[model samples]
Target chain A: MAEISFPLPDLGEGLIEATVLEWLVTEGEMVERNHPLVEVETTKSAVELPSPQAGKVVRTYGEPGETIKVGDPLIVFEVPDDTAGIVGTVPKEEAPKRRVRLSANLDED
Target chain B: MSEHTTLSDLEAAQDNTTAADVQQESVQNFPEPADAGATETMSMQQALNRALAEVMTENPRALILGEDVGQLGGVFRITDGLQKKFGEARVFDTPLAESGILGMSVGLAMAGYHPIPEVQFDGFAYPAVNQIICQVGRMNYRSRGTLPMPITLRVPSFGGIRAPEHHGESLEAMFAHVPGLKVVSPSGPNEAYHLLKYAAARQDPVIFMEPKSRYWQKGPVNAGADAAGYSPNGSRVVREGKHLTLVAWGAMVARCLQVAELAAEDGIEIEVLDLRWLKPIDAEGLAASVAKTRRAVVVHEAPRTSGLGAEVASTITERCFGTLKAPVERVTGFDVPYPSGDLEDEYIPNIDRILYGIQRVLEYRRG
Candidate 1:
């Protein structure tokens, strides 16, 4: 089985800690990339954290009302056994670099 | 040897004649105006208009683009009659799309024109956020110096006037967070006019925010040398005091002025600082003010969390730690979406809240 770890995404302004307001998905439930997993309240406003990878939720590190920093793992997930080899593999750095370039082109003249 | 010397002497004589002729033509032009005294008292809108008019007249390449700027002269009439005075080519209106307006301005700037585009309202500027952050903000760095986009975005923002949702927003932090952009907001008419003129001359992209609520407010404009002190990247001490430095920008500057007046009544002396420029902030001036006052309170109309005030407070604390007598406090908008315009007074920090903040800081200093 493959493991999926969800890191905090940028909620704007390089904000680090956010209070966990609620968990939409529970352990043992399946989730898809970009699916809302937890609701977090920042000093500015409440935001929903999306799953970065598709997998079955195996565990949660923190409960509601706890504040977590950036890069803190919120949920762990188990992927299909067949896809286990690719599950935890980190994408090449070139991928993000290329994507940023492409997005920049779309907006830049 | 004699033939070569003769040819060289002839070339030198021709160069001297050409240089003399060029100097004569330059001297024949009209003389510039003499530095004169300052003119006091102009509305914020008038200040902006004067800045635009001055810049456009001084620089032929400078132009303005915004909705209703051409015929209707903008909602607040800041651009009133500019189109007629400057001709449509220099000052004109755009389609109702903020993204289109900003994106087109990027293209215009790339073509070597200085385009100062206006977002009609604070809330309406959201559509262009993508263009602003992803494109306009990073274009210079992304291009690796091959392109320099010197566009100024003029957005009239903030609340207090009972307008609909999206009318009042202090989005400076959003722009400030971007790496390659500059952000500025003026507290009064003089600053608005002077800052706009500075923005027109700048070579980098600038987000110039105007306080919508204070559009009609009037103040000493200082038409001469005092105007020179207003720059797009500097802060000014609007009032003199010793106990604490109260920092604010845009419409809040006026509010801070009112607070200072009321505080004076209570026998508390407070210095008011107008942080005209948001990005590339005047750190030196701010540090100096905080050093003298020993206490600081940053105020803004934006929400308290992750707002521009947070950055100012942290910076002051980091640089002026030993000099500070109390923890830097912030009088800002409640950590909530801007409330209805009617309840804005409650949500937005006012004279009373600022007074309370001053009292708290003073009390902390006592202990």
Candidate 2:
């Protein structure tokens, strides 16, 4: 098992910090990716930040009415070692399909 | 040696020079395995992730710093899980300041740390050009070797993803022009894996242009094998042909291969050469391929005016002048500013345009 932290990401448009309006998931709660974890309000607007990856919530930082800076850990997750938490979509590994078979002829002058 | 001796030596060298001596030295042979041992079918993104993991593991001094790199695992997740695997200190994020990201890397490099900084997107690198070209490129020369800027600046590059105006521009021509910066673009997953590792290991700063469009495309990558024989600074012939050579790099390499396939149906054999390194272009490799085919076409997504294609065409003309059947042709984007996503299909060199380029070269006459 490994512990992964989810930082308060820059919501958009250079908003540096956000105030924690509420926590959607509590400690030891299991969450799936994109599941709402917190509702935070930045200068732009109040937005619900989703869980970046699926894991058992180890802890969530900041309380209602508290502020957290961007890039600061908002929550942590305990996940299996192999699943290594990922944010964006890592395209599934599929066998490369190529119509024009090419060779890497490095030795050919 | 004395100035007089230098002059005499110059004259002696001139006396011994032959037509063969004028040709660019052939690229050094690196016996890359026909099959990378213990290969894993992986996407370019996964390969890059694996490479960074290996780089961090092998070199404690090597760390990655850029916008959204740490907890977020990069905007593309190329640095995914790296912070967790390594640590926050080694794989951390900076604020959305491109200049600061690069500037700090220069300082870190000066202090004996190998920094692998990502500019997030190709368009974002514009804000950091001053730091990249002035400090990162010239630091070692200016310091007279006292400080070597061993930096790997990763920029997700090129169009085809329908990105915004600035996000998909091809900046290889601009980076290749710099005196001290070494530019390399990997065409696929295997190339990305080996090339990124190769760039990170070098003492000089390398601009590693990751082909964003090809990031999701999966291919074989040997995680255990080291990129021993190949020079990341040299080009490689990905396909062999006798009719014509289609010279390209990055996303265009794959496109050219597709063109070659279509051309094959029409009985036209096309060679696709991936010009891996943009700066010290494998002129010898270009000459060797074009000389055999007696025809050539350079394809790129960048605008045609003073682009890298012009340099490539000129090199082929100079080296293969005696044996060439026709002038080198180019299939490239227009001279206008790289457009937004909606207009990308028109801006990037497509298969039909490349086929026309090949046709032009094949049908050229001495008249």
Maximum-TM-score candidate: 2
Error of 1 at B65 (Å): 1.2
> Which predicted model would earn the best DockQ?
2
lDDT of 2 by residue, B308-338 (tens): 9999999999999988877999899999988
What local lDDT score does residue B328 receive in model 2, on the 0 to 100 scale? 91
- DockQ values, each candidate: 0.01, 0.12
- Best of the candidates, lDDT: 2
lDDT of 2 at B168: 79
lDDT tens digits by residue: candidate 1, B1-367: 3322232333343221121221101101111124425676777777787778788777666778988776556766677667767777667778999999999988876666678999988889899988888888777677665456678899988886666678777899988998878888888776787778777777678898888777766676766555553334568888888777999998888778777776766566789988877887777778888888888999998998899998999999999998787899999998888877468868888667887787777766334
Residue pairs with backbone atoms closer than 3 Å in model 2 (clashes): none
Error of 2 at B111 (Å): 1.0
lDDT of 2 at B111: 64
- Per-residue error for A12 in candidate 2, Å, reads 14
